[model samples]
Target: MAFVEPGVAAVEARQADRAKIRAVAAGRRAVVIGAGLGGLAVALRLASAGWRVTVCERYGSIGGKMNQIEEGGFRFDTGPSLITMPWVFEELFEAVGERLEDHIQMVRVAPLCRYLFDDGSRLEMTVRLPDWLASIRNFEGRDAAGFLRFLSMGAAALELSRATFFERSPWERPSMADLAALRRPLPLRTVLPYATVVERSCRDPRVRQVLNRYTTYVGSDPRRTPAMLSVIPAIEMLHGGWHIRGGLYRLVRVLGALCERHEVGIRTGAHVERILTDGNRACGVGLRGGENLPADVVVMNGDAARLPRLLGQTTASAEREADRSLSGLALLFALRGKLDGWPHHQVLFSGDYSREFDDLFERRRFPSDPTVYVNVPTRTDPSMAPEGCEIVFVMANAPANDGDLWDVSMLGEARDRMLARLDRAGLMSALSGADLVAELTPRWLADSFDMPGGAIYGANSHGPRRAFLRHPNKARRVGGLYCVGGSVHPGGGTPTVLMSARITADLIGKYERI
Candidate 1:
């Protein structure tokens, strides 16, 4: 659907209404920089709440990492093909008095994903708990019970963490009271200490590898990622994975339409040169082309780490230290023919998962045998491709950018190695005779998204400190400024970014009220 910009008359009327509301001390003028998912969500919510909102996007299109690339007769979603937590999107639509179902069609998948182990063993992880247990039983009989026990523990941990950790705003550090509440919960205490959820869940190395893979969803290393992340799978298993019709990028289009419906102003291709700060307060932003947009509040939907640079200031050492998260490398391909044997989602594990991660985090180099993720959207939605064609998204974790290693030679070699690895894993046979489609590398991600080091999720989800040590929503030194994105609070993923937007909007609402 084409985006319909709000009419000038409607915008003026909304402004007049907001002015009247402000006269009664009820509203504020807000500007959101970067029309990424987080920024778009925040803008929609605030506009729905009677605030005069404007969204500025540097890119020609919205979606940030969740962008769509079209070439020839093929189209591919560049980032985050999977959608979980449908309720988050529903909430946004509800805020605007629209139903999510009215705009986007979502289909829930039964077998969440199929995992191919290095030893050639395959396991299909299902959304149904019993089916998942059955798969575990098929692999290791008695271990099946242990798997169920583990999931039970994971479910409890999810509840505790979601309530205590995920719900709160990242701007305010949790006090002794918060810590005390977290400690009082048994499941939280049990899950909090482990380096990896798989460590406490199973004894088999393969099982550990399977569970450890969840850490990658947040751009984290299982060995160092908090155990609380086990809830990730718990939530997915309980709620199920969803596929949005017409690609997930349609979400951005729908949201952009919703923003217009609420009279929120959106400006595309508007690069923000610097955040305009009034002494210690951010009053607005300066455009690269010399246009200055004014507002009482500024919400940044770009990478949190880039905030200091955008503000034309050196990031504090503490701020820099707190911002280490996982970055990623992805390869999106538009194939000429269909792959018969592949599922919608597939995960291929390396022989030595631990050593592979060690190569990444410890040595800061690409792994010899990196775990590979393949997403064949055509498996579920044939319309995404030509009559018999397919769209494939291949991805793996790689070093963001260290300045010297991102040379073309290195990138080309990495791409060749990945394709070869897929061939060795039996994927190439399925796509035999299929034409080579478009290829997007980490460099493309960096160039397109303006993310430092091509990192997908801001910092690595390492220790508990990493989880709680996110960049604050409100700047510590700058007033009238806020950040909402994967680089900041609630962390990465589509759902989390949406939550970050809600949290940021709530903060803005509270600030305006005060």
Candidate 2:
């Protein structure tokens, strides 16, 4: 199905309604910068509570990174391909008085992903507990029990996050959940980097490597990210990875419909150049066309790091670059024929995982032997491609460096490196003769989204400080200014971004009177 673009007629009607609303109280008016998932969501939420919200998107469409594109009769979800913690999505719809099941069909991805190591050994991760344990036992008898213990630790952390971390803002005073989570002594494992924890838990190098790969969910290096992030795999393995029937973009479609239903104004291609402030308070936003949108509350749904610049101050971005998360080089291909027996998701592991990360994070360059992620949504949802054809998404981590021009020479070199890694896994032959549909580099992301260096998750969750203390939902220095999205509090990923919206909306209701 084609992406559901916001109707021009509907947007103009909403814009007219917003003008009428402005003539009234003005106290309930909210201007949201960037019509990303979080921005659209919070706008819907506030509108439900009698707030007149107008979301301005720099891009021509909504959903931001959670977007879709179509080329050569193949539909490609350009952003996140997997969905975990399904309840988070359900809750968002329920909050807006809609049932998620009624709008979208979610299918559990069986044999979640296939892992291919350089040594010719393969493992299929499944949600079936018995089969998964059996695979571990067959691969490494000792690791079966070790893997369970590792998951148990992750479960504990996830449970703690549900109450304290995910539900409330970090700046909020300790609630009962926060106090309860702190009642016990902190585990020593919590302080150790995730890689160390993984090494201690899994005896097999392959198992440790797979476990370390979870750190990339938050765009962090495994050797440095805090162990609390173990919750990533725990959530995926326990709740299971899922795919929407048509495509992941279906979720964005439903969200857009809900936003429209709730009478939230959505203005696409409206670039906000500056967040107009009155002394210490945000009053509205100035669009690039010199059209100033006035409001009582302004919420930034773009990169939180860009707030300083929008507020008319410059930052020493070098510091941000040093602390930025890893970006990715994505190549979308439309293959003429399908590869039989291919799984929905697969990982081609690099021979030297540590060295690959060093190249990406420390050396600030693409890895010569990069680990590649291959996602063939057609394996599960054939509608993603034309009949008898397939769409393949290949991605590899790259340094989020502003210096890399990603010119033709650079892109060619990166593509060759990715193909080399795939060839080593003996899968390149299947992809031969495929047509490259589209490509995304860090530069494209940075330029399109205004994110610093195109760091997907804003900052790397390296040490505890970086991991726990992200950009807050409530802007510290600017009154009536709020923030949401992957870069803000509670951190990145689709589910967490929704949670940030909830927290930000709640904060606005509590602090600002309608």
Q: Using lDDT, give the best candidate's number.
A: 2
Give per-model TM-scores: 0.90, 0.93
TM-score of 2: 0.93
Per-residue alpha-carbon lDDT of candidate 1 for residues 1-514, written as tens digits (9 for 90 to 100): 1122224543453344334444432457788998888988988878877788889988899878888888776778888888887866776676567888789998776567999887888888877778878888777787777666666776887666555555557456664645765775455434364444465567667777777787788877777776767777777877678889888988988998989988889998999888998888888889987999888889998878778788887744433322345565677676777687678999888889879888777777778777888898888888888898888888877876545255778767777767777887888776556555656666677788887667788887777777666777777788889999988887888988887886676666555554
List ranges where model 2 is wrong by over 4 Å: 1-27, 184-186, 315-318
RMSD of each: 5.9, 6.3
Among all windows of 10 consecutive residues in model 1, the one with the lowest summed lDDT is 1-10
Model 2 poorest 10 in a row by lDDT = 1-10
lDDT of 2 by residue, 1-514 (tens): 1122223543353344334433443438899998888998888878866788899998888989888989878999988999888877876776667778899988889889999998999889987977887888878899989888888888888877876788778888886646876665545696789999888888988898889999998899999998888899989887788899999998888888888887888999899999999999999999997899999999999888788788888753535576998899999999999899899999999999999998988788999899999999999999988999999999999888888899999999999999998899998999888998899999988898787888999988989988988999998888999999999889999989998998888788667754
Query: lDDT (0-100) at residue 448 of candidate 2?
Result: 80
